[model samples]
Target: MDRETRLQALSAFLKAKRAKIPPESIGLAPGTRRRTPGLRREEVAQLAGVSTTWYTWLEQGRDIRVSRSVLDSIATALQLNIDERKYLYDLTLESGSGATLWKEESPEISPSLKKIMNELRYCPTIITDRRFFIVGWNEAASCVFLDFEQIPFEQRNMIRLLFARKELRRLAVNWEHFTRGYLAIFRAYYGQYVEDEWYDRFLEEMKRVHPDFDHLWQQSEVKTAPDVLIEFRHAKAGKMMFHLTSLQVQGSADLRCSIYTPDPDSPTENKLKKLMERK
Candidate 1:
């Protein structure tokens, strides 16, 4: 993990990924027919405020020194999060540069949250930590979560579920759109606290359990709180639509409450009510 060549490989990979980002994506209009498929070297150079030669060397995996200012500029230009930025630092740092020590914290959902889950058994709600760990969930969330009691409590991660569960993929009406935001939320939360071993463990599990997620993560496409839309085949109301609303806990910084809502005038509301009434 602390190898120079490995860091170089990561840098080269970033350079390649950055090269494909279109100027239009960053509000810079495409000027004319270009040789490259994505943004030109000079375009990123101008935005990043570094010599084209240095950035070129960075892309080529050549030896060059990086300044904090320039690195920050590049991070902003590439829209890298704390993890991705840390990865960049890891890649560019000299061997034995001493990486930031990642710590392990409980960040578990509170007992009150557990009680709330029990009381709100009618709604499919979950109480997760900053790292998206499912510390508390109701029977309703379990039903929606699709196998709550079976999966290891530690392995009950939202990102892992999106990739590992066949029902989550097949049953979710708009999987691609819904799943895209999970990483965004993950990245955004992990950005604030990068030293969590649990976060790394979750990441490792994601890479091992789901190759598709691994590929996307490697692309360094960090998402920052995206609106999530999940559709379901309701037992009573037929097809349904659900949107998750996230809110930070008032006192505890680590916890967040995510409530699922049905689209207005949609069958999902009625279906949810029927499901609740049955139990």
Candidate 2:
């Protein structure tokens, strides 16, 4: 990423984090009315033991040198967790004046990987690249979600489907919850490909199409792959719950396989069986 973009990302992330903190929780009195949510910039500076001007400059994305201690203090003031702290450093510290390493093309799924996906009998599995393009999926996945084969190659992005497809969005019981985590994961990967044309194009299109997406993109939250329990309301099977797990492919760092396995002792397994039978 370029210095300017890196600075902007850092600023956005800091702002977003700051917005989530309540002044009273930090032992500060809830003062007069404010135009926005969370602690003000000056309040953040005070908490971090920095001058208001310096903190303001940082938020303004001004070109200035900052120390590790200051960054640490700011991170603490923002209540950032381990992954978010690492992300803050990645955006501010690792960024330098150089071209980002770009892949010539999207990573292709190897034959073995496809075989592995195909072998997943009961679980719904899907393979995606760094940009979240749906490269392959199993029959169970299609039966539960929309069939990837029906969508055009260019429109097969996971993020896009989550936002734009009404059927899929309706199926996800915790749509907002799932989308926020998904967007954070996407933002984490996006840091590595800020200058890639395809990434930029896809992002722009999403922003244009979905106002909610555009709003959330400004939050600048970053997350690695998530493993969590997700609930779905399938049309044919009623309510179902699964443990969503994501794993990197063995040979390809940029490729990932996400699987949804029915939760133990849940009706999801029986529901999935019925759904598959109907398929």
Candidate 3:
């Protein structure tokens, strides 16, 4: 990512993170007539022991040199968790100019990876490129999610599926909750690939087409957690719940292997078996 774009992303991330902290959590009284959500910029500046104007400039995406110590202070002030703190560092800190970023080209899924996914007969598995485009999948994934085979390759993106596909929206029991987390992950990557125009175009198109997507995108929240619980309302199975776990491809950190395992407490396994039988 370029310096300017990285600054802008850092600005947005800090604002989002700042808004999540409650005043009372930091031993500050919740005074009446407070308008902004969570901690104010002045409050963060106070907590981080920096001038409010300088912090304000940071949030405004102005060009300024930021030290590791300052970043550490701000991170502590924001009460950032490990993943969030790493994200903060990634946005602000520069690797050497010789350091390589992930290539924009999609990573090729190896035959072994394909075999691994295909062998999981009961688990729904899919492989997504860095951009969250579906590159490979197993039979169970097609049965659980819609048949990706029928969709055009470019349109088979997870974000597109979530926002554009009514079928997925209908089946997802916790649509907003799921979409927020998914969007947050997407936003996290968006910051890392600031030079990619595809991200810009795709985001604009999504926000234009889907109001819900626009609303969520504007929030600027980010999450890097790989595990999520998803509940789906299947026509034949009634309700099915799955724990979705995402693993990084050993040789390809940018590629993600996501598996949907049936929740032990639910009838999801039996339902999936029955549903797969009809396939």
Off by over 4 Å in 3: 1-3, 94-106
In model 1, where do residues sit more than 4 Å from their true spots? 1-20, 24-36, 57-68, 75-108, 111-123, 189-193, 196-205, 234-237, 250-253
What is the Cα-based TM-score of model 1? 0.71
Q: TM-scores across all candidates?
A: 0.71, 0.88, 0.91
lDDT of 1 at 273: 65
For residues 91-131, what per-residue lDDT tens digits would candidate 2 score against the true structure?
A: 76764212344354556778888788888878999888778
Predicted candidate 3 versus true structure: per-residue lDDT over 187-223, tens digit per residue = 7677555556567678778878888887777677667
Q: Cα miss at 270, model 1 (Å)?
A: 1.8
Instruction: Give the best candidate by lDDT.
Output: 2
Candidate 3 or 1, higher lDDT: 3
Candidate 2 accuracy as lDDT: 0.82
Residue pairs in clash, model 3 = none
What lDDT would each prediction earn against the true structure?
0.64, 0.82, 0.81
Q: Under the 3 Å rule for N, CA and C atoms, how many clashes does model 3 have?
A: 0
Mark the 10 consecutive residues where model 1 has the least summed lDDT: 94-103
**Per-prediction tally of clashes:** 2, 0, 0
In candidate 1, the residue pairs with backbone N, CA or C atoms under 3 Å apart (3 or more residues apart, or in different chains) clash, namely 103-195, 184-223
